[model samples]
Target: MSNIKGKLIALGGGDDDVLLKLIRSEICDIHSHIEVIATATTEPVESGNAYKEAFEELGCSNVRFMHIDEANAADTTDHIERISKAGVIFFTGGDQVRLASFLNSTKLLEIMRRRFREEEIIISGTSAGAAIMSDCMIYDGYGHYSLIKGEMKTTHGCAFIKNVFIDTHFAERGRFGRLAHAVAHDPEYIGIGLSEETGIIISEGNQVEVFGPGVVTVIDASNTRFSNTREVEENEPIAVEHLIMHLLVKDYRYYLKERLFQPLTQTMPKEEAGNVALPEK
Candidate 1:
């Protein structure tokens, strides 16, 4: 189980002004330090600069970039210190495989996990970066092929979030089938499909609040009646029953530990006569 007390913002590809503002708010002020890890991107320098510019435009002055271009960069003491000092860390989009290959078991990852669990830092990632936030991540597979049993390729992720699988560029890329197949394979895990420009901010390890312009799709196979995942061969169409789905928009909240979905209004407490009472869902 993940004991992370920090905030994690997982975003799909495209505009992230809202996310940047949120990160800034979590930190000190315009002078608060922010680190951007562009290891997943092929053009790390370019991507890093882009984020630096974006943050700077948002009135942030102390923004740094870290890239795993070489084998030893992730393990260097300098890199570790830089990550430790940051109030907020962000990851840019590209190929998740590359990011995992470079930082999976490195000292950088170790520090990141420790800081997240021990401090009040904020971690944000987009696209491929978002996909790697869970224990089990979808590394590869398209919508059409993903529906077939054993077609989607998955790998171990950073494991910042437990018992959940994340996929980005969901609605825009038509990845419902991909997430559905993933949920069918492991009914115990919740599959989150994030559309472009949308994201989920996970707090206190379990509470997830949806944000942005697009939708956030939650696929819960916990009560699935049946699936032929093990019996079917590769390329064979999969069959599943009773998979629950929640199409959430901005302000919707989902509790991972309870597998419950509720609007933000319902989850918030009502203050009346010096007494606080939470609304029952």
Candidate 2:
């Protein structure tokens, strides 16, 4: 439930009709303004146009396409104004680096974060967009070599959410080792691997509800008895013991503060929101 004022929605990747409908429900109404950001994509116009169409198909009359790149000014009065009026800010998938590097500390991001924290608006992203939600993110890591020490890369993210690392296309790309290695390297932060087409709605800072098809894997290493990340050579695989993990699907919820997962009871909240995989009809 988006009972809280602020909400963050992260999608692993892929778009589904049901997921789009769920996203629509986050806005105050169909008439609410939506800004589709394609800054992460190489073809921002085409990518932004597609999402603009998708939201319009959901009956959003005031959807606008926004593309910010190295060549443009992100904090212009016009961009700031549109972001202020937007009810939902949607980020399209592409390169996480381009997305974060461009907007990391912009006044535009400050406004968006403020609105998300103080208003009923939503801050949502997919794929690369999803990966940039955490304070630190996995910028690079191939699935096959992610386990090797120093293979995965991390850097400052949007910091919309803290003490966590997010990875998209988890299941499809077989990124378990990639994320596992990340958790071992930075055990202070929990690891969330979102499968393609899956997503999680995060609210009240710690509550996560699953809403799409696929799997949401949560990795916690706070209680690990041992780790060799410090001693492992650059090419050697790191290790961690006593690491905890949980898998969630639709109708399940995981609490970051509690580090626990529970099946939704029959009395689940009518309103659901947050990141990763869901089942297909």
Best by TM-score: 1
lDDT of each: 0.83, 0.82
Question: How many backbone clashes does every candidate have?
Answer: 0, 17
> Compared with the true structure, what per-residue lDDT tens digits does model 1 show for residues 1-281?
33667889989888877778777776767887889989898789899999999999888999998867764478787888888898888989999888878888887888888888888788889998899888889877787888887678788989777778899989888888888888788877889999888899999778898888888999988777788877888779989988899998887898776777788888544332224222211
TM-score of each: 0.91, 0.90
After superposition, which runs of candidate 1 have C-alpha atoms over 4 Å from their true positions?
Answer: 1-3, 268-281
* Candidate 2 lowest-lDDT run of ten: 272-281
- Model 2 C-alpha lDDT versus the unseen true structure: 0.82
Candidate 2's TM-score reads: 0.90
Q: Count steric clashes of candidate 2.
A: 17
lDDT of 2 at 202: 90
